[model samples]
Target: MRVRGDDLVKDLKKLRKGRGILTSSIISHVGPALGEADCPLSDRELEILRMVEEDRTATDIAYALHLSAGTVRNYISSAMTKLDARNRAHAVRIARDQGWI
Candidate 1:
């Protein structure tokens, strides 16, 4: 950030102006703060993501669980929303990393 003599003031001003607001990752917490539940995801959502982590297809999981495929997908989608995940894999990753599943 060293600028020559008189240019230092102008350079610093420009740098300060360009320094945008800071942001951080949003994490969902459970426990007393939430007033209920141990994790953000429900038991069913955790179960589905665990199966997903094992590389099971949605239809396969539905068959094994005696639930509809659409229901399984709905659980996955709900988990994704709760974990702020971009996709099914991301949801699993987040849940696993948090030890939720």
Candidate 2:
């Protein structure tokens, strides 16, 4: 399904008001956890994380980096495992909190 530009902007605004804005408590919670976790992101993983930080989707990242979507997914999965994250969003949070992304 194609998302209209206006609708996308509206959704982003809603997200910013809700979960997208990172508050102090969220930063505090994620900070300490990062130092204690085992490092799981390889060079490729780091790249994927950076792209995700820029709001790129898996397909976008794969296409930009000339990698397969499966490979990008694997990198994300490995990063999540290493960071002990529950999901991709969580992993990005951890990575950002640690200044790893």
Q: Best lDDT goes to which candidate? A: 2
lDDT of each: 0.70, 0.71
Candidate 2 per-residue lDDT, tens place, 1-101, comes to: 23456755565576678855432233345436655433446878888988888889999999999999888999999887776677788788878766677
Query: Candidate 2: where is the Cα deviation over 4 Å?
Result: 1-39
lDDT of candidate 1 over 28-70, digit per residue (tens): 2222244533477888888999999999999999999999999
Using all chains and alpha carbons, the TM-scores for the candidates as numbered come to 0.65, 0.61
Measured with C-alpha atoms, the lDDT of residue 81 in candidate 1 is 76
Tell me each candidate's RMSD, in Å, in order: 11.5, 11.9
